[model samples]
Target: MPAVTVPDLTVLPRVSAPGVAAASRPVVSITSAPSGTEGEGFPVKRAFAGVDLSVLDPFIHLDEMGEVDYAPGEPKGTPWHPHRGFETVTYIIDGIFDHQDSYGGGGSITDGDTQWMTAGSGLLHIEAPPEHLVVSGGLFHGFQLWVNLPRVDKMKAPSYQDLRSRDVALATSADGGTLLRVIAGDVAGLQGPGSTHTPMAMLHATLAPGAELDLPWRPDFNALVYVMAGDGFVGPQQAPISAGHLAVLGAGDALRISAAQRQQQRYATGLEVLVLGGQPIREPIAWAGPFVMNTRDEVVQAFEDFQAGRLGQPLPHAEVGDPVG
Candidate 1:
């Protein structure tokens, strides 16, 4: 869970607490992610499963890639695939990954690095462990989030952003008990490095055991908190939440999270969570395998375009690896 760290949290800028008049968001629901395999059988936890789409507007899908330690020659990743009408945010907490897309947006990202790929109109891409990582496997853990674009921007040109860990906006709770890594959007006046087509905020926070973080949030944006490791309580009611759980929050100007006094031995460091929110798109969403559109007909058209080779062709060099599965 070493996405980013500070030797002393007190040295970082402190995130101001919500104003006295601000209301704390309440936990509307808590759901556990279901385990599954993706992209050539790499393990994943479907973080958004069983949650209503309307409650997650602007966020289409999320996967907790793995916390697994792989033996040598065991690392795995996705095969070449096509995507449209959305952006894919791949954040690596540990280990390495190589990405190559048809539109010349590709790079190698390792621990604490992120690759933001906007598959606006469409594109073919592949993500896989590098050759050396495959030959000498180690721990690989990360998350991939699918952010849906508004109907107007569904056909926008594709773009890519490589965000290194050092570029993230770092902050701490006023009490210096938590480390905050702002990846996108603004947090307490601290702006993250990644630019987004949609108005949203994504952050990873680690709270020391027994610490509490009362974070100011946008009243107009919907809020969500996903526990990546350790245990904690969320919302004004202090509902219990643990690793692999997602908590949907109700309208409010602030979010409340408190770490338990004791964490699982493996998570002794603290409670690790990813907090995200966005202004709801409030538009119809027609999503199918790998494609997300505002209407079923558009989704069908996407499939046709992909099949007709209009999406894109795989780079000649990608052929050196496994053929598109």
Candidate 2:
């Protein structure tokens, strides 16, 4: 079940969509996911959208939370904070992430669940490991992505899309080639549940030994792929990419990815990949802790609004924590 081979789904495009993608293979430019100082008690690897790597447009930032094991009684998790002018998407793969917001929204996402929260205007939120997990100890591995909001929608109302594991649809590649867990946008022939603020696709794929997938993407959109587990190859030349590396794809109509085959003497395993993309917002970016806006003054106003309790009052019973990641 490593490589999910199935009939080719490339032919099935959105009906009557204009500007059909022309057939061309894209190339991969591999880079490592950037690491950063552990913020608060949370240990995470930053993937970009910081001052160091300011290339991912429309997408502000990305973080990969521990692929490490937590010994019993060990402490870890993001604290509480306020956000405005953007959205945060949290995908929990290995543990539970309890969430509470100043907007009166609260929930816990366990394995394979995702929380897509829009912090438009403003909102205070916390993402910490469940107390039970802290007591028992276990693996805490997941991803959190920050996406920029269009200027027109920057002040839109905040909202959330809490998708359980089962809500994310899977698409198999040609002849069972690859298995894709679609979180947003279109994958193969299936659409994800997330009602996106911008056009985008957030897909997770697993490749066995020889599985492969080709995404017919819009040329105007910017795309990137991050390797999460094992090794894989991208494009026609099969450029090798090890785990924790991200490939910023070159221009073309299709993005190809395949699991690397093992040598006769080497052991084989599955490769896990996370693919992300969206139409470039192409707007001026003014960023601060938890706030992203077009102008510095707007960002300052966000902080002012928070201080004035415009975001909403925190729950008296809620735990105190920071949202720094």
Candidate 3:
């Protein structure tokens, strides 16, 4: 219950690839999540928009958590979209999620729920949720991290933070088989109540089978580890990995995970890992889908301020079209 004593993953300093680049240290990249191919029904693989790592420099993107099996009615989710700059946590973990936006913010998250949002200067969201009372089961798993908006706060406006599941902050691992859930920053000692504008950190582990955990890296940020369904041993080069894979570690100082006693329950004890990165803002991004401004005229002035409506505001329980697995 009291653990945040972090600081040990040290190894940093040693750049010289293209020659020098290390503001505070955080360079670790990894991208791997392929399967959903044959027709895309995703019998097993499903990365709607997952796998996309970006080392430190202020944590650009991390999306490495997937699952969506809503077919009882059709229409899945993500509708009234439009963001500006960055910030969109959205961790769900099992099923259900309603979400509304434009600044009014809405609700419904169910399964362990977590909906961070912080679009900055523009908004226009929607997540929808209904149908799929569990027939095909394993509805809309989760993971939707996409941060990057520190260049002067990118716009400073849009915001939200509906973290539930008992206000977060849990940390167990003696033989109870790992738990740790400080979903924002800080680490073991625990301190994740959502209130990040950048300078990030997030941990949401779970072991169970043969369990054995260490995790505590912040040699200035930029970290990685996304396995999610089983196979163990990470960091300290125990390597190994499994379920979809993604370790990516280097400028280290702390990290030591375990679980293989024949992998305990034969792997798959829950294992929904994701320990994002931060400390990187080499600016000049200016993306174009779901907005990510920097230029291109601020994405054409954010679609002309949502077509002159001035970025509509008034969310929270404003259900219109629901269905999110």
Strongest candidate by lDDT: 1
lDDT of each: 0.90, 0.74, 0.60
Give me the runs in candidate 2 sitting further than 4 Å from their true place.
Answer: 1-22, 37-39, 49-55, 263-268, 314-325
Which candidate, 1 or 2, would have the higher lDDT against the true structure?
1
TM-scores for the candidates = 0.96, 0.86, 0.34
Ranked by TM-score from best down, the candidates are 1, 2, 3
- Maximum-TM-score candidate: 1
Q: Model 2 over residues 1-325: C-alpha lDDT tens digits?
A: 1222334535323222123445544554566776654444667776762233344777878888877688988747655677889999999888778888877776998777889899898887877777888899988788888889999999998888888887777666664656677889875457888889888889888777776766777677777888878777886577888777877776666677888676222325467888888888888888887788999999889878877778867533323223364
Candidate 1 residue 69 C-alpha distance from true site, Å: 0.5
Give the per-residue lDDT digits (tens) of candidate 1, residues 13-80: 89888889999999999999999888788899999999999999889899999988989999998877
Candidate 3 or 1, higher TM-score = 1
